[model samples]
Target: MTSTGMTGTDTTSTGTTGEPGDRTGAHTDTDVAVVGAGPTGLLLAGDLASAGLRVTLVERRPHATGNLTRAFGVHARTLELLDARGLADELVGTGTTLTRLRLFSSLVLDLSRLRSRFPYLLVTPQYEVERLLERRARAAGVEFRRGTALRALRQDAEGVTAELAPPGDGGAVTRLRARYLVGADGVRSTVRDQLGLPFPGRSVVRSLVLADVRLADPPEDVLAANGTGDAFAFVAPFGDGWYRVMGWDRRHQVPDDVPADLDEIRGIARRALGSDFGMRDARWISRFHSDERQVPAYRVGRVLLAGDAAHVHSPAGGQGMNTGLQDAANLSWKLAAVLRGDTDDPQALLDSYHAERHPVGTAVVRGSGTIIRLAMARTPLRRAARTAVARLVTTVRPVSAAVTGMLSGIAVSYPAGRGAHRLAGRRVPDLLLAEGRLYELLRAGSFVLVAPRDTHPAAPEIAAAPGGVVRAVWANPSRRGALLVRPDGYIAWARG
Candidate 1:
């Protein structure tokens, strides 16, 4: 087992016997191996490959499925991230722009108050997002091993060794060696299970019914109800008289226990919509209960976890996918740095990922749990308290904005490390740049400095940088380059 020149052919099994030909062929080797082909994994693979690192992506699914509309909303911060990679424009072109998010109960709180150029949400299914990212990853020369599952893993000082099995019917196992491994698998991740990490959280008592229905008479607005008498629903218009209806089953029924018949779905719809709405077509339906769980740590040894593997909470504010994408963005650059041998201190730099992301995950779980609990309060006294709080929040602009900002992921900030400026953790606003937008600057490479207008001071000495592309840009404050921006679309350091 030499450290160098390990490709797709070398094979040595510890316990399980692999397919005869598996060891005969060259084994695929890369700087990083990513488990799961979901949004986070695909985005991470694309980023790592684009950064000139060999990346191998493994997915247990035999092929891509575009049927499930799991996550339907993309927040402003996530939009900014995609925009940075030149994918936002394409996404906005395909998806509908949600200008307003109206909370319905005894009162309404407009989500448009969140500060940003993209003050609204984007309505795009999770499948579309994965498709775009997968395309980008393939274009970047990433090797995607579809229908592959990790059978076993062993890490040493040099790199990680993963034994992968093909999907369906026990097939030959292939050995994959990489400098690092990323677990982006869903809640029940084999990677997390192998790592012996504890996922601590409680499941909600009541289960909810979700459906994508084409209504004969659709609601005029996007409505999110906290407590609507007997049911709670979050309705978002997806164009063409289609609405994504999500509501809690007052009877607290599970998917298996209750029939998924159209009549049942329509009953739930009518309860929330206040009308016997005729559902012409029902695309998909499922029952799910809210669960709040987060991994104690995002990293262990050479393996790391992202997305649902790292944190799982109620989808109250649609923060799941957005939070996972942010996880990919934040970890990609640092991993690239380590792989490129820019620094010898791997543990210190890697620890920051957990430190920065854990708090945000905690906040999301706590906040979303609070919102869901208040909305589902059964007693009259609790309902009154919830309504009073909502009204009071609406009356105070700052308080309301702050609450909305947290849900939108605009309030996430990182701690300033070595060589980091005050703006390191803060998100950089979209500004006009010579290249095009401030996000365009990030597409080139990581650690960018937007030089102040009319000021050409000596460039900061950036170490282990990627060629000359990592230099500062002289931005025109009047047009663009108003301030320096980070890869995560946050202000690293800015000047007026």
Candidate 2:
């Protein structure tokens, strides 16, 4: 039976609510439907809905929890992106500022070298970031459907058809049809599975122990690290005297079999931080080995993957969340353009997302792998060598800046194709505008081109692109200018 109901309830065979009727007959229609309400999905949904697109976000989980501490730091670039969306100040206010990231081994490297308004990392739990994003998404009029799972997806000439099931009962199936679908699901994404995408990568021989615990005596320092030998430990202070501790298991020689017990945690802390440390209550604990992997492509037909679904790498550099957020920002603008009939070449623009992001992901995987190996080298010779290199780099100002740039994600640049200027593929540094700050100006919407230098003769033509906003100003000379900044805060084009 062909039913034209908007309530998401339609009868099918077997008397189930959402069961597909005949493969040919079932399809629900909307502008965009996003699978998973994680940070990426929520942020994308919010951006799309805020831009006046109809969006529906589905999550498999029945309720949100505060237990997991999956990701801990939001880098400077991420803060700038959120600030562009008017979200950074609120989030930064809640999380503690990581003034310095000190690397300790045979030698020490202080990360205060990176210059930014947000010079240090912001330490906030993954759940808290998600909570804030979810609130913002709701405020932006995103339709959030909790306790829903996407069972199957099929795309055709017009749009995509997704079969969704309610959580526990598995009672009814709803057919949601959308012009496009995004899979913001995590590493083990069902959408990826359905699309038959290849997630190729390698897993390191060693794994690390990660836990969020209430220490009897938390470290006074914002972050402490001991990386002298095969055994290494890093402790960072979260709010409320709780600490997130990560360390290598010296005795076991691997991350597997590391118990989630307080006793084991205390023992690790004793080795990494000194014997006097006391660990009282364990909040959450897990074992994770580094995996460097990326999907060969970001899109298959109308379904697209973002966040962990597209790339999963070592947590050593804290790039996971920041990368995911940027992915959403990049995709959101393109998706909005296509939905609004402003772009004729949707696939070309869609391909640009992967083209721009894949290389960045590759670099992150390689850089983070190097850092992890250096931190976990067992042999005395290799450890000594790693220590010497770290110390040398720290002493050199340019080298330190480079390392800080890598960690802060400010150094990433995307391709601007042929005939693009030097600023192509670079992040536009926050600049001073005649009216206000550059970041403040971007808070309104996506795609801002700043003509700070007044050098580009084509500034008028470039700014006049359909559906784009360009701001022209005189060069400060103290700062960089004439940048094509994406909604995600990365420089798409720049001038020397």
Clashes of each: 16, 9
The residue ranges of model 2 lying beyond 4 angstroms of the native Cα positions read 1-28, 104-109, 167-169, 205-207, 228-230, 253-259, 452-466, 470-472, 475-481, 493-496
Per-residue alpha-carbon lDDT of candidate 2 for residues 248-295, written as tens digits (9 for 90 to 100): 665655546655565665676677667425766777787777678898
- How do the predictions measure up, each by TM-score? 0.87, 0.87
Clashing residue pairs for model 2? 17-172, 17-173, 18-172, 18-173, 18-174, 28-177, 413-425, 414-425, 423-494
Superposed model 1: Cα runs more than 4 Å off: 1-28, 224-226, 255-259, 417-422, 453-484, 493-496
Please, what are the lDDT tens digits per residue for candidate 1 over residues 1-496?
A: 0100001112222222222111223343888999999999999999999989999999999898475767888888898788778898788766677655555565455667766767778887788798899999999999989889988888765667999998666899889998789999988888888888889988863567777877776666655444555677766666545667777757656654565656765666566656535666878887766679998878777788999998998877788999999999988876776677554444555656677777888988898787777777778898888878788877888887887788777777765545444555677667565556667778875756566555543423323222333444544554443234445665544443
Question: lDDT (0-100) at residue 27 of candidate 2?
Answer: 49
Report, for every candidate in turn, its global Cα lDDT versus the true structure: 0.72, 0.72
Candidate 2 is scored at a TM of 0.87
